[model samples]
Target: MKMSDKKEILNSDKAPEPVGLYPHARRVGNLLFLSGVGPRKRGSKEIPGVTLDHLGNIAAYDIEAQCHSVFENVRHVLEASGSSWDKLVDVTVFLTNMQDDFKTYNEVYARYFKDNQPCRTTVEVNALPTPIAIELKCIAVVDG
Candidate 1:
């Protein structure tokens, strides 16, 4: 088989537009690598649960809302790339404020990953590209 057949870039119209120049996920062999995905709504710049100040700073945010939306965004990318929520093998979560958000995020996460629990790592970061509070990087298995 040609080398090209082993690697494919996958983009989902239903997912939020990537903040950088990257596909939503890249398929390599039987695995899919998802770029860091935020909770921005598709076809718009609005970030769920984020209320910005006049100068574009995070005034207040809801971790629950962002968590739910980001999960949905990941699901869209996974399904579009020939995978499913149950196939997710690993996930990396980045939060702007761990002390303030981790509990809420984890609670929301448990509801979503209750059945297909994937290996997960959550860390606090200085900030993400946008005003959103959370972002997720994920990996999944893609079966032929």
Candidate 2:
């Protein structure tokens, strides 16, 4: 579909506004591509206890919390795409500490995708935006 013809869903009142040069979610044809979601709370600093170096200075880096935040952002994006978690077809997880959080991550990931889990790829990266621990991007099929 043409850019002008494509439909954009913006829940400015309920969802976090786009922070960069992209929309939160957009639907084109039968596919929806959601931007990678960070751990930042809606219109607020990221929830505490989501940092890596906890004992030193409580740097906002908690692997479990980051996973949940990413999931929450994915949920919002899916809802905006006229679908829900069940419609997801693919997912890409980015993390800085894959070795340390792989098991815990899978545990939480399973809750969101309890049946027919979508195709997924997990990659351990050197770092992420703002040096966060995790990021998630989703793709879902949109129903007419």
- Report the C-alpha lDDT of model 1 over 42-144, residue by residue, as the tens digit: 9998989989899988898899999999999999999999999999999999999999999999899999999999999999999899898999999999998
Q: Write the per-residue lDDT of candidate 2 for residues 1-144, one digit (tens) a residue.
A: 665466655442334555678877667767887877766678665553464465543465567777777787778777866888888999999888888889988998888788759999999998776556777777888887
At residue 47, candidate 1 shows an lDDT of 88
lDDT of each: 0.94, 0.73
lDDT of 2 at 14: 39
C-alpha root-mean-square deviation, each candidate = 1.4, 3.4
Give the poorly placed runs of model 1, Cα more than 4 Å off.
Answer: 2-5
Give per-model TM-scores: 0.96, 0.81
